[model samples]
Target: MIEQSLQGRRAFILQNTTLEPPPHTPELALHVASEITPIWKMTEEALEEIGLPPPFWAFAWAGGQALARYTLDNPQIVTGHGVVDFASGSGIVAIAAKKAGAARVLAADIDPFCEAATELNAQANGVEVDFTAENLLDAPPPAWASVILAGDICYEKPLAERVMAWLGQARAAGATVLIGDPGRSYFPRQGLTKLAEYQVPTTRELEDMEVKKTAVWKLP
Candidate 1:
């Protein structure tokens, strides 16, 4: 979910991806991989050998597309507010929030390459999104952020547990917390309030089904 890209990674992105709108949220365009790109054929070890991590930034995941749709449709949730987009792969959610009139948006990811990828996507969308390669989970949520958005963060048990605990802290501090998940195993359901759900279109490569039942949830 994070990286600080040297020139090579950014170059790879520029060479490999095209400006295309995600299937579910077609209102915004991003720098994303196409089926024909070399990125798809590269293995994890191959990517690592080139000093790159898995190119999560190259695809728009289901959770992010769901949250982007919800936020755009209901701008009141983020309009005129300072927002933070956590683990912002491809900057899809961040760009959507900005388009929906968020006063300011900060996109944070630990991957160095995500910084470059998000920046490129933001520019392509004609929106301004401040991004940090910093792993925001390493510290407290910023005091000025009134809205916090996390997408697909529950894919891993340890990450889901840590993110939920941290988001809980943010909620306690009065920030509105929202998560987009496709019923990932590590994502708990009992305590959260569901706001919206969608059958998000996804690729077989990225999800179990061609369309996933995903939901947007608010931390109680």
Candidate 2:
């Protein structure tokens, strides 16, 4: 069964990674791979053997770290509102929103492994975040979510375009949409109102530099 496979994958992730605090957001801790290459290789092998996607949930990305820090510092943004963290890898931002006093927080990702990782990470941080493993690309933002948070979602062109359009729709529908991006190639140059920026420390294995100038933006 799918649930059984997800449990096995979760065990594998826990076995391979260590629970530690992310560099930029030390207030939160997650189970993350210590070295990037080893996990990258292991995930590749997993892909060949069991059709697993890349293990992006095993690390705290720059955009997510920046967003989490911003949310914690600016609790008024999410407090008393229902939030949805789109592509919620490791559930870092979702946990931050919950800690910031959001009425409800939902972490949604298409990858089942990410759901497992999110659940574990939320528990580690002493936060309650619901998880949904749904591919919501074609769907409109849920009416219950007053805020939709997306992080590091502009890596690819097609996905970037689709997410931007969907977030635009969400914005028009009276939901406040926020995006955290590290200036990826496909990040939109327009239609965003910059809110905050952070020099997020990151691993060179994942990015070209040791620190990424990341920013949080509001969808227009």
Candidate 3:
């Protein structure tokens, strides 16, 4: 029954959105909403009807774009390693990791809709990425993950704190941890080493500015 419901939701999302390449990462395509307001309203209505969270899986956020661009350019960072993309959203970073030749890629998110979106986007890019709806933050980092990727995850204060702690643990366990951020209020100002930065093009409907100076950081 849950599988059927997810399929129905995936169909609804594909019908309402376009499959296009993001501005910064042109090599990969995803099912993306053209306008933020209409999709946001539809997502809100869907949440009211089904008790789901907002549909963040419908857009390629600035931080994700910057991370994806960096991953594609610096393929050696993920090559031949097992990668886990946390808060996977549209699966942009996961796709990039797979394209970069990661031994395996898992896209993890709490939202069931994100699992469906990740699968669809992975197929579109001709790469295989496993999807998990589990909230992996509730437990220790998986032993199989040799590298962990997080993109645009520091929006809320509490969630950001929790994720940063978990990511720190992962780093201590010897897994390379990387984060893509647009300097949200919740992002920790300390303990991160910057790797790359990009002026990611974004829509004003979702962000205050048209271009976000996003950066990818390594957690130590």
Candidate with the greatest lDDT versus the true structure: 3
Please report, in order, the local distance difference test score of every candidate based on alpha carbons.
0.87, 0.88, 0.89
List the candidates' TM-scores in order: 0.91, 0.94, 0.94
User: In candidate 1, which residue ranges exceed 4 Å CA deviation?
Assistant: 1-7, 35-53
TM-score of structure candidate 1: 0.91
Each prediction's Cα RMSD? 3.1, 2.1, 2.0
Provide the lowest-lDDT 10-residue window in model 2: 46-55
Better of 1 and 3 by TM-score: 3
- Residue range 44-143, candidate 3, lDDT tens digits: 6665554455577999999889989999999998999999999999999999999999999999998767887888899899999998898898899999
TM-score of 3: 0.94
Write the residue-wise lDDT of candidate 1 on 32-126 in tens digits. 88652367455233355554545778889989999999999999999999999999988999999999999999999987668888888888889
Please, what are the lDDT tens digits per residue for candidate 2 over residues 60-103? 99999999999999999999999999999889999999999999
| TM-score ranking from best candidate downward | 3, 2, 1
lDDT of 1: 0.87
